[model samples]
Target chain A: MKAFQSVAVIGLGSMGLGMARSLMRGGHEVRGCDLARDALEKLAAAGGSAFNTPAAAAHDADVVVVVVVNAAQTRAVLFGPDGAAEAMKPGSVIISSATMSPVEAQEFAARAGEHGVLYLDAPISGGSARADAGELTVMASGSPEAFSAAQPALDAMAQTVYSLGEDVGVGSSFKIVNQLLAGVHIAAACEAITFAKRLGLDISKVFEVISKSAGNSWMFENRIPHVLEGDYAPHSAVAIFTKDLGIVSELGRKQSFPLPVASAALQLFLMTEAAGMGQDDDSSVARLLAQIAGLELPGMERSN
Target chain B: MKAFQSVAVIGLGSMGLGMARSLMRGGHEVRGCDLARDALEKLAAAGGSAFNTPAAAAHDADVVVVVVVNAAQTRAVLFGPDGAAEAMKPGSVIISSATMSPVEAQEFAARAGEHGVLYLDAPISGGSARADAGELTVMASGSPEAFSAAQPALDAMAQTVYSLGEDVGVGSSFKIVNQLLAGVHIAAACEAITFAKRLGLDISKVFEVISKSAGNSWMFENRIPHVLEGDYAPHSAVAIFTKDLGIVSELGRKQSFPLPVASAALQLFLMTEAAGMGQDDDSSVARLLAQIAGLELPGMERSN
Candidate 1:
């Protein structure tokens, strides 16, 4: 596959910045842009150009990757006044790497297509660490031409790219499905850990035992350590799941499908957000459970 | 560990039968009992004596293991007419392998103490396959002497024995916590997969993506195959989670702790059981979700 020689990465947040560095490392002339000046400066210091607007970044790019927070931000970056889609060349691809609904993804793809740009419905996973390491997993689907155009950036930014199909919405559908389970498992992990604390078992011991047992999940193994260490610093914040699972809930409602587990998990994230821990690590939900139950977790002072 | 020379295995169901064989394999003279004649005959063929009653099996045995369905059956086997506790010799140990509440386990331990018998609150996990392989994980708690008396059988039947504490109820508490997550995860797996189907994504592809993604749990990896192949034959049945998560809900209520995710999962299992899939594989909850959404899952005919 021929590598895109010039790439634009919009929304230089944790994930986007890491991906921008990865693209630069993969021999692309990368241009980065974000609302945060500090993030843009970091990208500039890493030998890539930084821009104040998506349009400035995408003006001469072979590929424009929109890695924003949600569908609205994605749309704003792509089609807002002086948007990247307007600035980019016709044959260039726009890789949309936001967790959103399939319908929203299809809408974005159609809008990009109208601008004579190829669109790849790509949603990334594996967190910021893997993103920085060029090892994220990308669930991607779009036209063959879009895939061909985005191949270099995808190869640089992802360790595995699941080519879902030619359908524009398929990648987002898979991502929403994944978010459904990830959100639920995180809630379940928090519930289990705090429930063990309520039951008077040593929370660390419970973690050790459960991680080796049938009750273990990816979230449990990954997030329980934050609880054990009493570190609520956000690797992935509680608000993220609230947003992602909210998307799942919205889509489920639109499809008339009952997503009771996802809905239940979404409530936990909402509760965590309501408790003022939205910006903390998602594992802070365990502390929220401990607080409601009137129990003290390791490293957490009683909030009341 | 001094191996108990004479052991009685009451309740020769899947888990009990496997433990009985493991004990016999460990060079113990095992006496087995079950209501099912087929289970009894299988035990007898394995060179263990099979009895029609718990007391008959416990008579002259140094250790009696009650591996029944729940606390009710555990109580029946230990204290009912012709009970094993009455038949077991003084100073012998009664190892309870059933999953129940901490309160129930404490009560059982006290009653065993009244009979001048050592009691070990040991609730086994790792399923029947692990049990048959002598590789189950046991969450155990009891007195020093009780641990000493149960060590031989514990070694024979389990790969990992988590000595939670000397407190009689500690093991059961840990087991309940494990069950809380296990049940929720299985339900979440069902919810996520069926929701994918409802969204019109390929279910098998969803399974492939999820198992490799952060959405995965031990339950998801182990049980999603049942959904993928449309084979719902019981590796573990729906009624199992109904009972296990019921214990979690009951315990949570008693503790005034809100287990919202687990509660939601419990409702799913209850619905699955109410729909007459109680004896089907636990993954059949996926079928229930598909039915509710009017979606067809692989291997499941549309019930409507």
Candidate 2:
């Protein structure tokens, strides 16, 4: 394993924190940063140094992983006030693991290049559970040097890192494609289950049958349990897809590609958000659909 | 096994022919009927007797398995001129395996009862390959007597027979739910693949990553190979989803439930049908999408 002696993980959210711990477990000297004090403290207690800002954590690191929310946050973390780019050593790798448009990724990579830093446009999949298990799948694209530089952290955090090619934005493009399908599938799963509920079929039975049938998706298998158990505790929240699919819609518009199915799915996520369940598990879109149809879902009471 | 000595199968389509052969292999005196002479001759060559009409084939049969396309054809096969219902024994079972509304299943069951016959609302999954292998899944609902009478053929035809309940419509309800999801997932797969193409990512590479990642569906796994191979030969035609999702749309409208995602999927199938690829594989919807987006899918010649 190509092992970086010192690695900095900026943004200690669920995915970031898990990744940071995984890197530490892989025997790297890890530094973590996040605005959330609890997240910072948790990593600190786990035998890694914690910093309040990205730059301070990244200052002496051999490799920095930016696992922030989106392109804007990724940019802010690297180029904002007290940003990591200036503090990082020349030739250090920046592994950007945010879901963003290809254009943004390319721009970010070019900016990082200007700072004499190699950038790997890497976007991650698998939920935080996989991240905690150190088995996340990464879609990555960059120069050979960037991949070689990021190898240590990538090996520590990912079970599979798709070496997409030499283009800076290809990873982002792949991730966007994945988000389009994933978001559509989640909404479709919610729609199917609620539609089953509306049809008076046993929702659990529908889940069981569909899981074994041609109807099933990875999202359906993973997310339908939340609907079945009436547990909307967000493993992946409604707002996450709302944001992701919004990116899809924006990209589609720019490309003159009409994504009608994705467009429809986005509307459902938007409706879920509009119903104030944006922070809830995405399966709560089932609840919203049920509400609109005047159908009662298992763990939901009728407000009227 | 509650083994019936004799069985009759109506509508020798791909699914019906496979199921009929499976019953024959199960040691039943299987009789088959179809309007298509080629289908009937194929069954006849396989050692099952073939008849010109449903009644002649069903005459004196202990179980009549109706495996037609939809509710209307199901109704016509059982009760139309020279129908099977009038010719079957009084206590014989009628297994309706078409995808239909719960109301239609119930009405058919009631009519069968009036004819002094038993009815099993058994809708099948697992497609023609499984049907040929006699390993299909059957979502079945009927009286104990009806189940007992149909057991031999069911045992031959299905690996998993989900006994939904005593109610005649329950199996149809489950089936409708499955079709709703299956149709939507297929359309979602097409949309995602085409969207990937629009983004200039290698389609096969996108398929590889997404299949291992979260965006995958059973349909995606099964059907995308057809797209990747540039083979649009109809394993399941675009018209099938057009018809099945039409059922979904009609059911949604009748129940006043908005199946927005399903409606979106239905429109895509409708467009595929409108583009005259109705007889091609359902994945041709991806080709249609590519054409619309001015993208070239593998094996698709530009029409302009």
Local error of candidate 1 at B298, Å? 1.8
Question: Please, what is the TM-score per model?
Answer: 0.98, 0.98
State how far residue B226 of model 1 sits from its true place (Å): 0.4
Expressed as tens digits, the lDDT of each residue in A212-245 for candidate 2 is 8878899999999998888999898999999999
lDDT of 1 by residue, B142-220 (tens): 9999989988888899999999889999999999989999999999999888888887888888889989999999999
lDDT per residue as tens, model 2, B92-157: 999999998889999999999998999999999988999999999999999999998889889999
lDDT of 1 by residue, A58-108 (tens): 997889988999999999989998799999998999999999998988898
Q: Ten-residue segment with the worst summed lDDT in candidate 2 chain A? A: A1-10
User: What C-alpha lDDT, on a 0 to 100 scale, does residue B74 get in candidate 1?
Assistant: 95
Name the runs in model 1 displaced over 4 angstroms. Answer: A1-4, B1-4
- How close is chain A of candidate 1 to the true chain A, as a TM-score? 0.98
TM-score of the second chain of model 2 compared to its true counterpart: 0.98
